[model samples]
Target: MSETPTHTRVREQMNLSNAVYEAIDTPTASGEHAHKVILRDCLGTLAVALENSYKFGCASDATHSRMLGHFAQNGLTTNNITYAPYPEYRAYARNIRRTKPKLYSAPDAALAEVFAAYGDIARATWDTQGNPEPDSRHAVHVTALAAPYALREYPDLDASLVSSYSLVHDILEWHAGDTPTLNLSTQGHVEKETKEAEALELFCTTFSPEYPKLVTLVTDYEELVNDEAKYVKTFDKLDPGFTHFGNKGKAIKELGIDSPETFWREHHNTYVRMSRYALDFPRILEDRDTRAQMIEELAWPSAQ
Candidate 1:
């Protein structure tokens, strides 16, 4: 089937990102070089992020062929002229799928993290050292920044579909990870009060009112995800997942849930709901006349 105009647009973006990545030069090591490289790297994978993220009407198989074709064309066999793979199809298609968010949301989480890291880089209080070092923060940002468009696009996002706030929620607040004042990932143990609910609360507090539906959805999601965080905290004494956290399956077991499959049923259902809501934002959040006033009313105090 001929690619839809929407998919074509995605393709154009993909090509553009590839061009930017290939053409962008990393200047002599310096903060300025680092910033340019950072933005360049972000544009580099935005193609795939857009591919997986942009849904037309409702989540469906409409983009599956194009997704596969995109990967096939970008793979090693394509012998394309681009120096680096624009959309590493293999990476995107690691798991065949009927929809984008059905199987995994990590890429979404990962992409969100990329953006969050952008905020981090922006918010980072530089050390006494003269220039910012392209350290782990830059590495994590770049790593997540590079992604190919994914397996079958999520079913067409329709009115019935609800977008997910997970990525947006997660990207905003972090756990014992990188922060503006500290490198939690490397040396901070400020795990007190930092949990999924804490994360959701921060996002909810930050973005709600301006986005009431967002507040409602996450307010509900907090009830579900909060337990996972509690379990993670309980098991903090043991380094199970090497995530400094325990697995959800184990969390369920400890909680006496029916089974892993049952837990995932809830997980994926919520995932689908969240995905739909997120997908619909383009249509929903189109006008800022209301949002502007709403944001002004509830905008973070420090934001102004």
Candidate 2:
């Protein structure tokens, strides 16, 4: 295994990160789709290493991230520069096999190892697309890291126009999710749902803009289900305070809509609305089962 100097390795990674940022984030970023895929892995490796270096205060430590904002505050300091890269990349690539089920070719693995070798990568918490978090600057970091990787593809900076324009699109989605709700009224509820729907659109559109037409079907289905949500009615009603514990059941005798069958019978119209959206987005119908499960959760008298 070859060992690159820690400083040289970091410089290389930083340069690659910058290239990747320009490739994926820049306005009118020019690149074939396949090029962006490899670039994402490049950014992921550097970002993971930087995050991990900050986490453990050294390249050799096997520790989870305790984000002290080391990169954010001091940037990459000298003490964090001792990276044993090729072997480090080997470890990261080998480890990927355990979690990533996709079959990787020998060349792909070699490419991943080389791509990952420029930094001291740390373990990353895998997250689902349903709830992307760290509501902070993750997207910025990812985009920033993408720049140097772009340079290999489009070397002439004077000739190529790369834009982090998607960063704005991503940030907009984050803003939408971060948009606060005043209350759980229909207005506030729709606003929140609409924002979530838009966020999904922005995220999915990174692959295809046509994605939204189908994705919206899921969003609209959710909105329709939310409309039938019992908690909506529960919010407006006055809480039956039991100042006197002597009377337990006497405080509230709200009509019970406990069973799924009962709920289906009572809210048949609402289910119809849900079905309509489901039928429209058949591609995602399997993903919308949360409503039936939620119905049971919201069946409590207090919830209703």
Alpha-carbon local distance difference test for all models: 0.31, 0.29
Q: Write the per-residue lDDT of candidate 1 for residues 1-304, one digit (tens) a residue.
A: 1233443433333353343223222232463443334432332233233344444221222223222333343342223443133334333333333344322222345434544453344322221232232232232222222222111122232211111221122232443233321112223234523544476666567545443443454465444344322221121111111110112223223333344344335434433433533332222122212322222223222433
After superposition, which runs of candidate 2 have C-alpha atoms over 4 Å from their true positions?
Answer: 1-72, 77-132, 157-163, 175-304
lDDT of 2 by residue, 75-102 (tens): 3311232212223332432333333212
TM-score of candidate 2 on Cα atoms, chains taken together: 0.21
Per-model root-mean-square deviation over C-alphas: 19.1, 21.5
lDDT of 1 at 235: 19
lDDT of 2: 0.29
Please, what is the TM-score per model? 0.27, 0.21
Candidate 1: RMSD over Cα atoms?
19.1
